[model samples]
Target: MNRKAFTLIELIFVILLIGVLSAVAVPKFIGMRDNAKITSELSTAASVQTALEACHGEWVINDAPFVCGNGIRSDSADFNATTGYPVTLGSGDDTPLDKILKNGATVHWKKSGENYYGPASDPQNGTSRCIEGKPCIGKCWRYDSAEGTLKLQTSGC
Candidate 1:
């Protein structure tokens, strides 16, 4: 007798191999995706920082006028008097920072005192080491208006 078919034992072995491979590969893929999101968020934050610096440069070149656009020297509504950076990102198409940061479509920004916080690309539950043990859903990027610094909270992401 001649046969050309996989036996039940052979099929079972194939299935087990596939399962093992999937188990090992899936977590790595997920980790990579999370890492990518973190990188993207950090890049966006850096862009915002650069824009802030440019605005300040212009402000300095123009003699640091107290009142410029809309009676506000800074680009956004949440202008920080100390660092010359927007404490809170503005909404609307006309807002300067909105145009610079792409209208918060990718990152939602809010201000608390002189600090600005934005949502991370991915929402995960963890504590960010950078934010005084603050619990973050996704990742959180904190911008310090006084020091002109940006901090990334990647524990959640």
Candidate 2:
């Protein structure tokens, strides 16, 4: 009586165990994927911020006020026209978040405040609350029209 291989019952049990483990791992993997997407989008936002600072530098150097708040010129050297920002770093349009979602990149962008830029869905967990629902300055960001700077809210989520 040599037990040469796993019995059918043992095979079934192992299969079931693997199935259960996979089921548990899959959701976590999906969540991580979504979080990674969100993090990349946030990085795009930071890029936009850097471009904006450069635009301000141009203004300081008497180059004129290039557009801010969205993408930069596809070629920064071509920022002379009144069309908008240059066109080197990024497109002169909505923020990168907007570009990703609107261009059907399998992600979406919404904001806690009117001016804030992030995902409409919960960025961190994707199941928690999305927007804080307070006004821009109160909850997400503040546009100091006088200083022309975007001030993150005290919460600064």
Candidate 3:
């Protein structure tokens, strides 16, 4: 008689194969996700860098300080007279990044798409290391205004 259903051995073999495939694929999937996150983080960093350079360019061209913002609106912000970068004050505040980024349209630097972006956990030291034990304000993509750096962290999982 033609078998209408999978035998016990066939079912077990299929289950094992699926299990093995998943075991291999799960780690790869996780790695891909981490890579994507790293890429996205780099992209965001580049955007902020471009914005900062534009501000600096304006300053260089004008030979004077420009108004990044009035600091009244979330979209508006303050910039440093010497650096021409946004006035972050290095207090773990997202205002500078947000304002420099024109933080309208859900560009909340504090939290961006399952990832948090803001100042380093330790501003005093100004040397933020998120994966080395301490996380930036509880697991975040740290933006160091002083050093003008964005720390990207990926997982081994």
Candidate 4:
């Protein structure tokens, strides 16, 4: 009888090769994942901006006041408050960015929740800080009104 099977040496070599490949591919995969997170954050920011603009137009025309966050929410109207740009919004729930980027990412807020932005979420502990040099990403977006941008930067995963 003839049996076809991998020899012990061949199996060992295959395992070593796999180990090597994994060692090389793991970091690259992690980096790609981080980049995907950043992309998602950018898209979310764009939506928030669009919502703010739309809310602003309506508020201006109807003379109404409301807040714009992840979603459009309004109570009644703030008769005492001035008519201006709506506040920014966030996921409200803690996000995957928090766990995955605990070391190399952060979220920032520019003026207020009204213009929050930054590295998708907060860094782990001492890895990074907002452009303002503050530790953010708990429940806000780092804001940069001067440049009119909300960035979510990461340290290459």
- Using TM-score as the measure, which candidate wins? 1
TM-score of 4: 0.44
Q: Per-residue lDDT tens digits of candidate 4, residues 23-78? A: 99999986665555545555566665565456556656664445443334444331
- In candidate 2, which residue ranges exceed 4 Å CA deviation? 58-157
- The models' CA-based lDDT, in order, is 0.58, 0.43, 0.49, 0.45
Query: What tens digits encode model 3's per-residue C-alpha lDDT throughout 87-108?
Result: 4522233343445555523343
Clashing residue pairs in candidate 1 (N, C-alpha, C atoms within 3 angstroms): none
Task: Answer with 1 or 4, whichever has the higher TM-score.
Answer: 1
Against the true structure, whose lDDT is highest?
1
In model 2, state the lDDT of residue 20: 99
Per-candidate TM vs. native? 0.57, 0.43, 0.50, 0.44
The list of candidate 4 runs beyond 4 A from truth reads 59-84, 87-120, 123-157
| Clash counts for the predictions, in order | 0, 11, 1, 20
Better of 2 and 3 by lDDT: 3
Per-residue error for 59 in candidate 1, Å, reads: 4.5
Order of candidates by lDDT, top first? 1, 3, 4, 2
lDDT of 1 by residue, 1-157 (tens): 8989999999999999999999999999877654555555566667777866765566666544544322344644556655565555554323424534545444456656656666644355332332333323556676776776777675422
On TM-score, who's better, 1 or 2?
Answer: 1
Give the C-alpha lDDT of model 1. 0.58
**How displaced is residue 129 in candidate 4, in Å?**
11
